[model samples]
Target: MERSLAIGPGCRAAAAAAIGLTWLTVAPAAQPRAASPFRLHGTVEPIRSQLVTVPRLTGTGFGPLIIIHLAKPGTLVKAGESLVEGCRAAAAAAIGLTWLTVAPAAQPRAASPFRLHGTVEPIRSQLVTVPRLTGTGFGPLIIIHLAKPGTLVKAGESLVEFDRAAQIKTAHDREAEYRDFIAQISKRRADQIVARGRDETELVEAENAVKTAELDLLDKDLVAPIVAEKNTLILEEARAKVAQLRKTFDLKRRTEAAEVRILEIQRDRALNAWKHSEGNADKMRIASPLAGLVVLKTIWKQGSFGEVQEGEEVRPGMPILEVVDPSAMRVRARVNQADVTRVRVGQPVRVTLDSFPSRQFTGRLEQLSPIGSPSGLSNKVRTFIAVFSIDGSDPHVLPDLAAAVDVDVK
Candidate 1:
């Protein structure tokens, strides 16, 4: 269950305004803004398709800390390696608890249940974003020390680091305490001191107790293959590509699926990894999830990164990547305020990019926003978001590469 992070109401307004403008040139133009000075300001926003912002990896409960060390920012390691040395003590606990009783299979889908289609990943939850490590307490996470990005790490080798001394101490402590608890339970059972699992509450309590103890171990360790290697690569590429695609989709996710959003390079990487890595998760990692040569997105910004820096901490869930699975690409642009009434789904469209000043792409109106509003930069003009899939492939065409689109409302 996760909160929906759709484009905000404000962003939607700007989008609507843009869509409405597309209609201004059609049928008959009774009004020509009458004047440019009074017309609200408008931006040629290259829309963004929906993004499956990767979820932050987090711990379940305290446990035997597992620490994996990497050599650098983006090191490639093999599965079954000790990123941080750990065994699934907590996982074992969870498994043991499951032996208690089988829960019903009818549990409704979790509010944010994983619904992966085409290539977009499920809402990330099973994977938690690990926090920044600063030589913390006894619990150790596998911290890899990579010499640099793409460094090849060996199978079962220690790539990520861990505080061995602290982790060892905790693990030993847990072992001793667990043994003591086991002894106590055995004694109680021998004397028939008290009945256990006699009531629902008792069974529930016992289950929780086991889970807590086990999670302590699970949290400390970093397990490999958190997700399948193929899927992990797809996710990595999708995030890495968002920066470029940001201009293409202009924040309208309804028309495009997440699978179509990974940058071209990343998609290539995924393809390569699948061909090689024998399906390894650690085989793919872009240099700093925020940067890859996203020259394509700059066209829409009139500059690269739209004033955002490589090292800046972006708001969580921003389209961190821009992808071009061209077969799935769409021209999602904003129509200006005075033209909202003229836009409609299935209306034919013509799009031309500033980068491709000589070329024009065609598509039909796939969607129109219900409301129109101002752009983020205090613009007087309003807009609506509209989307249309590209009819065919263009080698030079790219997401957010800028285009001049003419929609045929007729």
Candidate 2:
């Protein structure tokens, strides 16, 4: 039979305290142990296998085994492959922990890799640009004669000679005109002097006639009254004639001076034109700045683009040749943006000639462009230009030769 038992509050509290003590004593033993906080994630690289290390054990029942296993040549290893293994007791005594590293084994490469392709160029060069003949009033000139391509020239030598026929004719014509104007100016000066002298003489004569008429009016006091009045009118007429002559003389002098000035200006213009034409005609000859090998520049010709020839007619201020110093040589290379950061100025470099594969040259990285530019037609790819100055010169190491540059960079 089920029976209900009623207990007092003090008795119930004593029973609950007893149950709490039992749980507190057992909870500590029931929790799980914590996992390690440190873990490493990486791949196992196949390396030259080697022996493992073990320390001497004290009071141990078993001795550690030291095994040496070297992987075979061309061996490939996967991740998690055991490189070394040791007993926990031995590892802790030897290294406080257990890990060892070995470099990879070497294998035969199928082919040699290429670092970069570049072009050979001269280190020092002078571009024989078109002279500023146009600024000297000889614009739009045509090239009559030019030095042949690949011609070796010396300083002060004529590299290019322009056609000066038109300029020469203009100069001669202007000179002739200038001379004519000079002669006309001289004649005008003499004629002006003669006209001025004649005006002065007429002015003097009119003044003297007025004085004589005044004297006659004074004498008219002894003659009839009508005669005196007539004398006074005569004097007035003389004075009016003198005033008219003076005005006409001034007008004539001004006109003569203006004509002389006009003649002088024409002469000056003609003389300046003649001098400008002469100077331009002389500037038609372009001289070389230094002694070097001359290379012709390609220009737009009659219908197509080709090298500038002697017979080709070229305008003034057109570059027709480049003088390159072959002794000083260099290589221009374009390094991809991915590899540009690996290259630095003043670093040593090795260069190989494409034509002469056996020939290798040593040079220093002299220049590196800080800015990057798009390569070819692809805007997505960019490259930096690097210039290397060749250490020494070789006869076969000419400009425009294909080459390869090897840089030491990881």
Candidate 3:
């Protein structure tokens, strides 16, 4: 039972051969490995965006604006939609309001091929603001009505309505002044006409008296010495009166013309002021220039920065809101200098939103920055900015969302 059997030399050789073949097959399989693709992080941003601000009025006294109504944030809108409304704090009543249209400039398309990180942005957007009033002094603007923020609107829709009371009142005052000036000018002209007629009659009478005096002088020689001297004196008096009347007529006409000219100038100034006020009143209401979503700007208020609200006063030139086109969005990404050369414009890439990992978008490189900035890691290293355009639309593909981009080097 304990007896052992010895292996032959041929059997040992065969076992060694089998082991070598298995090693060779496993080594080859382990030596070859697949490389991972390069990825860059970026943020979603609107390609076109405008800052909304209070308009700078040309004349003085427009200040301390009060918001009466405001649009709810995140509204989808078309071009010309109403966004915000305001009025003057001192306004007593509302007046007829009109809409103002804004237009965005066109953006040129570019291509990029790289993985980079950037912000989401609309390709086009516009800033909504209170309109500037020219040629008149208006009081502070007050918000009367505002479109809900983030509203979807079309062009020509009302965005904001400011209290038109101040503008309307100013217009009325200017109009009244203009009309009064017109009446004064007319009355003055009529008075001048009556005075001219009276003066002409007096002048003619004086001339006739001079002629009568000359004829009477011819008879002076036939009369007594005292009578002749008296006739000569009468003739001299008539000639002197005729010369005085003629000079007065010319002076009066010149003075009256100058007076009328002054009134006309005043009337023109009043007319211009009235027109400016009327236009300003219409401008009180702000409208969307393009179809997009409404975004309210964060502003400093009461020692902190926040979105503007109804009944809050805003100064001229202060930022208030924005209308952004959501359809066309892009991501601005920063790429390492070393990887910059690997990417080119027009290269296809995959974009994944960090907020929603499940959502992935296909896009292409739109642009690459020519210059590079110093990297955080080292001064010698640089990073370049690259823009990628998302191919299609998604409700969640809004601006400012963080995204990961995978560049297809192959």
What C-alpha lDDT values do all the predictions have? 0.42, 0.77, 0.79
Summarize candidate 3's per-residue lDDT along 199-234 as a digit string, tens digits: 999999999999999999898768999999998999
Tally clashes: model 2.
0
The best candidate by lDDT is 3
Better of 2 and 3 by TM-score: 3
Please, what are the lDDT tens digits per residue for candidate 1 over residues 221-326? 3545543454445545544444434433343332222323333334454444333322122321223232112221121222454523233333222333332233
Estimate TM-scores for all models: 0.30, 0.64, 0.65
Lowest summed lDDT over 10 consecutive residues: which window, candidate 3? Answer: 19-28
Provide the lDDT at 163 for model 3: 81
Candidate 2 local lDDT, 135-159, one digit each (tens):
3444565667788877888889998
Q: Give the TM-score of candidate 3.
A: 0.65
In candidate 1, clashing pairs total 95
Candidate 1, residue 300: how far the Cα is off, in Å = 20
Cα lDDT for residue 207, candidate 3: 100
